[model samples]
Target: MSSLALHVADKRPEDPADLTGFYAGLLAVLNDAALNHHGWTGSVVADLGEIGGYVYMKIRPGEGDEPFATIEDLRAFRKRQAEEARRTEEASKQARLI
Candidate 1:
């Protein structure tokens, strides 16, 4: 089944360097993970404030068919009809030559 995991962390940044460091550390952790495969994708959203900040990281997994938008939904629907049409045209050309 498809699932979505969102990690929301409320933070107060003392300086710009602190926010930069926080993002860097998160990226490092993501890069260190070796088993991130099979439709695993992540994104980070940061809310900035003068005295503080908050960041939310969301990870989504692709699977199944449901009411929501899955990764597979976009990938499967994208260009599939065009590809099929191209293949059909090629087949028709080959039939004409034969």
Candidate 2:
């Protein structure tokens, strides 16, 4: 896919950690939408380029393969995943013990 750059102008974060946190949080949103089949999507595209190199986000609420999501969506997906993980873990333990 062709990449596009974003120009944030004066809204850039000074601390590098801020960028890292943003990227991670955004990733979580996208991952949740992708794995949960929830009615949403989250996306972020970033590039380091002169003039326009920047980060962009697209939040969609539909059954589409777009990287875009909301905080509430991510939380719900994580909770469901955690519950499923526990169930799987318990099942494995039971099988091993049998």
Best by TM-score: 2
**Model 2 agreement with the true structure over 3-86: per-residue lDDT tens digits:** 132122223356877865664565565546544654334333332212344444433333446545445454555567678889
The per-residue C-alpha lDDT of model 1 at residue 34 equals 15
* Candidate 2 off by > 4 Å: 1-61, 64-68
Indicate the residue-level lDDT of 62 in model 2. 37
| Native-to-model Cα distance after best TM-score fit, residue 68 in candidate 2, in Å | 5.7
- Estimate TM-scores for all models: 0.31, 0.38
Tens-digit lDDT string for candidate 1 (5-44): 4333446465876765665454444323312432344332
Clashing pairs in 1: none
Candidate lDDT (C-alpha), each: 0.43, 0.48
